[model samples]
Target: MASRKPQTPARKSWWRTGSAWKRIALWTLIAGVGVGLIAMVALLTAVYSTRSSLPSYDELKSSPNGQMVRVHAADSTVLVSLGPSYGEWIKYDQIPQVMKDAIIAVEDRRFESHWGVDPLGLARAVRTGIANRGTGRRLQGASTITQQVARTIFLSNKYDFGRKMREAVLALAMERKFSKDQILELYLNKVYFGGGAYGIDAASRKFFGHPASSLSLAEAAVIAGLVKAPSHYSPTADAEAAVSRASVVLGVMAETGKISQATAAATDPRTVKLAPEPRQNSVRYFTDWALPQLETLIDETEAPLEVWTTLDLGMQRAADEAIRKNAPGDAQGALVSLDRDGAVRAMVGGKDYVASIYNRATQAVRQPGSAFKLFVYLSALEAGHKVDDIVVDEPVTINGWSPRNNSGRNSGQITIRTAFTYSINTIAAKLGQEVGFGTVADMARRFGITTPINTQPAMVLGTSNVRLIDMTRAFASVGQKGVAVTPYGITRVTANGNVIYQHEVDTSHVLVAPYVAAQMTDLLQTAVATGTGRAAQIGRPVAGKTGTTSSNKDGWFIGFSSGLTTGVWMGRDDAKVVPGLQGGTAPARAFAAFMTKAVAKRPVEQFETQVTLPEWQLEPEDNAYYTAPDNGMFVDADGNPLSEERQPRSDDSEEGAQGDEQLDQDWIDRMTGNRPPAPQPDPGRAPPPRDAARQPPQDRAPPRENPEGF
Candidate 1:
């Protein structure tokens, strides 16, 4: 009935009567518009949020990436790099034009015309992304140079809509503030070039062994092609892939009018030669020792830094070779050398840095063995003992501790110089008791021995562990005529030619008395010339001591010339005894090898010493008295005397002096020419003047008319 009533205009409610295709088209258009509005709203929200959260443009420009910290050798050559990036920051104009063109042609042809965001590139990227989505392929990226700079400076490397919006906004802002060249410069410097390099300069130097300013056209193309994926196209990693990428870059350069077709055709990627890989090797240990010092020298800065260190590449290499040649097989060792001013000239921390980075020269804590007797001897000298003072070398016991000589033979009665030359453990122990162990420990500390010391009788035997650096520094104090020195590596730190920090050496603090140092130097020189350290002679006047620990666990040779103070230690890292290793053996040989190369460029100079005590005479009454104990304790001058047996023996004080050469392999080697012969006396040389050793004791005047008392 209702249909009958509406029959006239049932006329078709526009829906049923209207064209079906038209109706469907209208709805489709409406739905598309609605979806577009939603997407537009979302994009607008993202842009606004990202813009609000972006860092200020000034902040971004100040430290776009991490600062580059370089470690330079003594000659101002780069030794190593320490930072998130390698190489240095360069200005836009410093960039080679060929490199710039290659980059522009391959990375972004419209780089000069875009406002940070290339519209055509974005469109092409969108089309490609949609087409690849169905094929499930990796989506391609279309980032302009400015966009890359923006991301490098401000945004993280996350793939998200929000981050991309922020990148675009920041890139637009960067375009507004910085010129295109400036943006390009920042991009080149901030981009990662693989192989742990960041920046065009680093990449250039890393791959070509030269600087970016020296890049050729073909080289520029090779580097330019690496920006897309540094490791993937690294010439060092894969030459074929790198050459293929470079060829593509050259073709693009031709197409973009950056290079002529003939030039592109003529260039061959195969002709490109990479540099030899650098061998940081042991030099890295020196740099590692130098890095922590920067914080104390300069305030932290966002700009790149150049730290000029005191490392001599030649000396370092020689030291490394010496260790390799002479060090006991499978045993670890270290070598440290310092100039007279305490500049660390060479430091080899270990046998191989690649195997272990632990810096034995600066960080290892081990017993100094008899090397520490130098300090004990110094204490005794300060306590009124002369180099000619006689001490009995016999078995002695102190607090249940009896010390024995390394060779199981005693000189009976030996002068302090002879005792030290032989490194007699018993005489050193008795001296420790005589001067007080606390005094010896304090003396060591004054000479820069920071390792903890136990003031026990065994302390004289070098039972206390010490660092090679400290030992070298202690010897350096003696070499510098008693002036204390803090061993330093970095001489100056600069940024853009402006000095951030310049080290000012302090040469005023005297750690030991000048007379004591001089006397010690004289005695040590005699030791090297005629004692256990004879193996260390390098055709020059060398003052040194040889130290061998119990059971040959550690061996040390610490010495000084007028030019350098060096210390060499050979031992097992695990503290296990190394068979057949002794201070007078491998360690002394290494010392000679190192000093030979170290002093090659230096003019020869002798030690300067002046005797301070002229009128002082060693009187018999001034000596203490000692007696042998029934416990078989021969409390002689070389042995620790009990409080009750501290009686002096005057009869055995004057003994026959032995020859300069001792009955040891070290001495035999020197005499038989098994090693390099000592410097020969020049023809018709002047008669040697009377030295302290030749001076007669003023108290021994013809037994003095004791004839009357008899």
Candidate 2:
């Protein structure tokens, strides 16, 4: 053999006399050495590449953890977090052998020895895939716990080989970056274990209702099973699947020498019993209703911000419970509550948020029904009409318009207070006709009514639509002593622990006077104390109105206490009316539910609406005199009520103030919102109360026939 090889060294050139076999052997040896050197360089390069972004051992081992956003209750318990998970970080010496070994055995048996990738794993996966060609029983995962942990921390939700490759690459890098114990700690914190729980700490509390340090073997198996398919193998969702998975993990723990075979076989089937879940979805309904309004804060800001609000989560839950419990069997309801300062404390969009996201409190615009009468009556009280002022209720027509009471009967000669208490339509129409329509319209605006309303007399009947939030805000103004406050959800906005913006209270000054507001409050109190709102009465002197729209399409009950104001609206999601359902039935019931639950142990308070009442001035005469028309009072040349007679002797209207109070209580209650019809006098004369109207008798003709024409 030595004689054969030495000949090659003797002849250095290709053309020199050397055996062909010797030249071939020399070339093969050189090529093999070059390939080996190149492979070594490549392996070193790949290992270095992954380690570039990884932190050092000291950094991983010594640092304390922190999070991005954490929510705290007033008492300071962490309510929630959107941040890195924590709670379980044990040193290898302290970690349970079974848990640690199960993780390694079920995930990667060669974990203790491999730098990162295992050549045997790749070959086995390829073989398994080929064996299960079409039936789809392929067994493919060969990732070590390190690789899996790497993917969870840095990878996207997308599933593909590229991510897997990146996981393996990062794993190798991480091996160089951190020790084994550090890698395990990172893995524990990096993965998503489902149920909205992030770290082992949250998971412990979420699944076992305890801390991770105290988890039992049974509980440990449940957590171990979640590593493969969290949602599917959840003890809560599929106990059977979780049991099977846990069994497998247990077997691996024993086989891998992490635990004794006796220990593995000793696990009680009952050990993996799921923890009872509480109502995890808290205030979701209120937040859903508030989302659109919350978006407003975002629009007004420039940076990523966190919103802090005045929301009383307890009150929110109460409101939601009330609406849900009292909603009609087939109907849904919404409730909105606001503070006197216009801060929204709670808002329930519907009976259930998961069932539907149509936030009726903020989104649904429905007819306010008799609730609109609050504005109408408030206007009447402001225009110098007493709550006890007399108003007529008759079968008279104006411009062929006739209004009736809900009971479908004309109220005969009722006081303005009585008509309002009763919600009589005919009387309200007459009041609307007497007070100028514009007066009522202006009062409506002052009261914070934002919806577009018709100026016609029928508008007093609540023909326009209003949202529950607007109703809550408008009522909040009443509670705020006639100062309209816009209901705002977010009170303070912060970013990265720095307050970037804060909400300034907005007061829209309304009310003709403090006294004017007080008068309206008094009427509403009487409404709650004895009228349609009797159902809403609490131990306190709450004031509010009840509204049942035409055709019963919308039902509303809006009320307010000293510090809180609420509006309840009930109707079909569609505009179609639900028969037999009205404000008194559903909305009032909803309000009652909330009040009964909310007012417990709270002291009652009286309303401040007395300021609105004028000094108790009595009418001068019980039998006030009216001048005969055509006497220069409020008559035409023919001494007849001018309007109807002048319209080609039309039958399109009623002659004279045919309805009653000297006025119609219905009209005043309605506030037809006009300025008391300009205090018309008989066309030819004034009344006896004015000294025979200056003696311009019925026989006399006025200088100007229609000087104060409508």
Candidate 3:
């Protein structure tokens, strides 16, 4: 064929006549066009593939929203609501006109004119995005109301080009299938507001504590403004931000002719009063205490649950008020009150549950101070030592560790009962050393103090950390006449009126002998009546101990009334020492105040008393350096009378004068078989005014336990 054409003067075809570069350029253009068409088809296919199956117009006639789970208190009173959906659903007709207008003004100005997909809005958004690229500013959104409704009903909250394309297609379909009012109704019912609220009605109730139809102009503006970003514009989370957003909404409504300029000016978001956060859950601490037990008793399920607990609302309020009234101003405090049977009646973990959720009563582990001495004393009684047994309160060292009395004044060779009453650390430490620290730790564990304990000698003075709940449990055991019980909060749990869990009456075991418990009660009563815990006296037979750490870092008062055992602790979270803080002061007063109110309806009963061995018969000549005569006077090893010389002395002495009077003894020579002689007293010092030499300045009370050379 080419040869025949050449014979006719070589008539060239279109491609053969052109230059090589021109032909190559033409082919490249044709190929580019073909590839572009293929890409267009592929893009269309991808967009169609990504489109989600949407609900028909008939399906959107009714709202299909989630329901919330409500939490009830012990008294069957609705305390709070907990679930993904909060508050109630609302109908489109019930929505306030001001709220809807504000939403349209700010979110979609051309909503009425668009067919679910607005080209003008899209162009404007694209231009804005281009202008803000790499500027760290949020990109402008171009989604119409119908598009938003489509996405909410049929798509996830993903933002991308493909998702946008799919949303556009769905929005177009929605416009053709449904009316504008129908789309708006679906959007209003499906949109998410913050605080677990899902719709306009829920958001109105959750934040403003009212129905959507009852919204004021300012409130309506605030609710509409939250649609942009629920968390960012939450009224409770950021009031200023919410108010600012509301102002912007009001301005938009004014500009869009939805409201007059005067109306917008008069509507102040600051004047819009939201509900006071549902009264702050008056018994929130009780709920927190019962939640763990509630979880443990029930199986995992999404169904709503109701729990009946042992919390006494009156007692809870009293305890909260007392702690807030008496706790150190700069420190936090916790209190746990239980019935005699170990049922939790009241709990106050901190001053404000909303501010902090840490359960200090059950979760915090702190040194119990002298409150731990109760264990040491109980161990001594268990080890065959009577309450009246004698223990020297003189300064002594063991394993290079020496502890002192809190008063810095040692009453030499005092009775055990007396030592316990005064909270003497030296005697407690000596008793702990004598009874074996291991024995004390075991005793604590047996009494329901499940917290870890150390066998160190210092543990006798309450150096081991323990929880307030455990201490309250141990004290309740004593009040229960030796029966140890596990503290519990939930009494019954019912789901849909069917009892799922009912606390089998807590079985109790004897942790202490009846006689020992009675004696301990007596000892603690004495401590409250005439000793360090005097502030805890409630005009009745009460028993307790006062605990103060070395640097005032912790102060505790654990005591029992006739029908309840309560523990209170006051301290700083960072363990900083509180000035002038003492267990016998704020903590004891708090205990008494709480008890007075908690027991207002109950009658007072006497604590069971126990009689121990007589003080005189408790001694059996167990030492060689000291002897207890019939008159409770001490005699030296050389048969010399030292009663007048061995008097209560200042705790600062190191082999110095025994008391205000200075006296020395002269013993006879053993080689010559001569008798020992008593020495004369110094006449220069006349008794040192009794407490003058022993007492510290009023402002400088002796350091707690007079820390042993630390």
Ranked by TM-score, the better of candidates 2 and 3 is 3
Model 1, TM vs. native = 0.56
Ranking by TM-score: 1, 3, 2
For residues 1-710, write the lDDT of model 1, one tens digit per residue: 45554455445577777898989998999999999999878766655565676565446545646568888899988887766645777778888888889998998899999988899989898899988887865445678888888777766665788778778877776676678987888877778777667788898898898888888988888899998898689887688889999999999999999999999999998898899764549998898788877766776546789889999999999999999899889799899999988899999999888666678999999887778888999899878898888777778887778765432345465577766665666778799898898999999998999989888777787777799999999988988888987899999988988998888899999877888888898778766765557678887678888776654567788998756999999999998867656676788889999998899788767666421111111222311111100011122223243343232221221111122212333443443233443343343674234455434444442111000000
Residue-by-residue lDDT tens digits, candidate 2, 175-195: 887777777766665556766
Name the 10 consecutive residues with the lowest summed lDDT in model 1: 701-710
Model 3 Cα displacement at 515 (Å)? Answer: 1.9
Candidate 1 vs 2: which has more lDDT: 1
Better of 1 and 3 by lDDT: 1
**Sort order, lDDT high to low:** 1, 3, 2
Candidate with more favorable, higher TM-score: 1 or 2: 1
- Deviation from native of the Cα of residue 544 in model 2, angstroms: 0.9
Off by over 4 Å in 1: 1-63, 86-279, 407-409, 609-710
CA lDDT scores, all candidates in order: 0.74, 0.61, 0.71
